[model samples]
Target: MTGKIVVITGAGGGLGRALSRRLASDGDTVVMLGRTLSKLEEVATGIGERAVPIACEITSPDSVRAAFAQIAETFGQIDALINNAGLFQPSTLLEASDELITDAVMTNLAGTAFCARAAIPLLKRGGHIINVTSESVAIPLPFLTIYQASKAGVENFTQMLNLELYDRGIRVSTVRAGTMVGEGMSAKIEPETMMRMFADAGKRGIDMMARGASSYESTVDAFRLILNSPADLYVPSVAFHGLPAGWTDAG
Candidate 1:
């Protein structure tokens, strides 16, 4: 679908930035949404005319509604809405701060729901809503209780949402995702927190620190493939996984 309007949250950096560039190259008009206008502008500048940058705090319903209204006026139609904005602050349930936990739920879970709801009226028939969720739901991890819990909710929401939106020709799907490598992976958590998690993992016979993240290109490619698939074919979801780049039994 050349020239399709694709709205992506968190398009300022990481995999979101990469996807914006990738989809734009394929003739899609990419609306880049992020909390910081400066960061969104930087990304839009790189993509030239094919991209539009708008400041939006996904955690706020009012911000999301206004952003989507602007998007509807600009494009008149939306082909896809990618919910990629996420907050990952790793900490055990006992050790995590209350604010961190609230932020995680609001940004990862509520934010996604807000975007999807706002985009519904603007969505063209046969539009797609894709949620980016963590692979930890399938492969359990420790010290990321809040992060995993929120993403798991997103995954569940995607499935149920599919049933509701099916009659409207709007498909809801998700990507069970793994960590991205280098610049594609943005860690909002502190180094000390990470160190503590690693230490705890080591004590439990797990070596999370040694595990490498997936490359940005591969992760983007997975998404691209899913989007490019024939509409006549039915695909519930895509598992865009990064194999344990350094997963070892040395522990």
Candidate 2:
């Protein structure tokens, strides 16, 4: 993966920041795309010369197009794209507001599609696209109907993109991760709130072991695997830690 130009959406924070550092350290030129330029610059500073910050709003096509054009001009070409920008807001099917549902869909599903559309032309043969979705798509949890549906859309979109790009020698893969434990999680909500969400998730038979149990390192390893693998290799649709029944581990 040396010298390969990779574009990571939402590279400013959380999993995206971790992956940006990992890839940049491995000698890949990573373009950090996010809504906030300052945050992206913060991550880019840590990554040094290998990382470039590009402010982008994933939900807006104009924003994606402009960002990719800048990337093409600066880097000449893109070897891979990681559609990692996503939003998760818990909303039950019956109680979900239209705005909440729309926002989730726009960020998680439409955002990935918009980026992929802009990236395909820049990606030559043997390039790859990795969509960072969630395990919740498979094991739907309570109070997250909209979030689940948005990720489910990403999974389906990635599968179809893979088949569509097969003839062109481009591969598409997805990393459906479980609950990733990192600064992002801790920063988003307090411990008590997390406990309540976990308890509610448990009652829905959503498999807590697989739902909220992943370190940033583990998720980055999954990304590295996709990047280093051959074009024909396709990893599973989801990845997460396992907790046995009656197990109690929550902080």
Candidate 3:
């Protein structure tokens, strides 16, 4: 990974932060893009000189284009791009307002597409694009209709984009992640509320594995495999942690 320049959106926190740190530690120059400059700087500082912080709003094409311009100016080329910025809001169909659905689609699906469109020009041949999607797309669990729909859109986009970019030697892949339990995630929810939600979900046989449930290292390893593989090598259509029986069409 040495000397390779990689750009990761939402690189200030969550999985994005982990990938930035890991890639930087592996001697790859990581460009961290996020809406918050301070958060991005914090990640960059922790990663030493191998990381660069760039303020970007993936929902805005101009912001994404400008950020890529800065990256081009600083790094000269981008070898890979990871579209990891996304939002997750669970709402039942009856209670899901237009605002909720719109936000999910705009951020998770549209934002990913925008970033990929902006990065394609700068990405080198044989470079890779990785989109982080949720396993919800497969199960279609209740109360997460919007999130599932948005992620399903991402999956479709990734597949079609791979074909469109095939002639240019770029490859596209996605990580269909399950629950991840970790420190930062717990902070986002009240302990009691989170516990209650989990308990209720369990009663209904709907398990959210929580953040940090899967080691961050495993996700990074998958990223490395996708990036290091030959351009013609095909990764699985979807990579996920767990699934109920008959969830996939093969069953």
Q: Pick the candidate with the highest TM-score.
A: 1
Worst 10 residues of 3 by lDDT: 181-190
Q: What number of clashing residue pairs does each candidate have, in the order they appear?
A: 0, 0, 9
The better-scoring model by TM-score among 2 and 3 is 2
After superposing candidate 3, which stretches have Cα over 4 Å from the reference?
186-212, 236-238, 242-251
- Candidate ranking under lDDT, highest first, comes to 1, 2, 3
Q: Write the per-residue lDDT of candidate 1 for residues 32-86, one digit (tens) a residue.
A: 9999999889879988899999999999999999999999888888888999899
Candidate 3 RMSD to the correct structure: 5.2
Q: For residues 1-251, what per-residue lDDT tens digits would candidate 3 score against the true structure?
A: 46779999988777788888888888899999999999899878878999999999988889988999998888777999999888876666677788878878889999999999988999999888999998778764555678888999999999999999999988889888876543334125446646655676677686654322464545677787777777669674547463443455663
The numbered model that scores best in lDDT is 1
Of 1 and 2, the candidate ahead on lDDT is: 1
- After superposing candidate 1, which stretches have Cα over 4 Å from the reference? 203-205, 243-251
C-alpha local distance difference test of each model: 0.85, 0.82, 0.80
Q: Could you tell me the TM-score of candidate 2?
A: 0.88
- RMSD of every prediction: 3.0, 3.6, 5.2
Compared with the true structure, the alpha-carbon lDDT of candidate 2 equals: 0.82
Model 3: pairs clashing at backbone N, Cα or C within 3 Å: 180-210, 180-211, 180-212, 181-210, 181-211, 181-212, 181-213, 182-211, 182-212
lDDT tens per residue, model 2, 1-251: 35789999988888888888888888999999999999888778877999999899999999999999998898777899999888876656776678878888999999999999999999978898999887777775666678888888888899999999889888898888776667544235446646666788788765454533556756798888878887666664546553443456545
TM-scores of all candidate predictions against the true structure:
0.92, 0.88, 0.86
Q: Which ranges in model 2 have alpha carbons more than 4 Å from their true place?
A: 186-196, 206-212, 232-238, 242-251
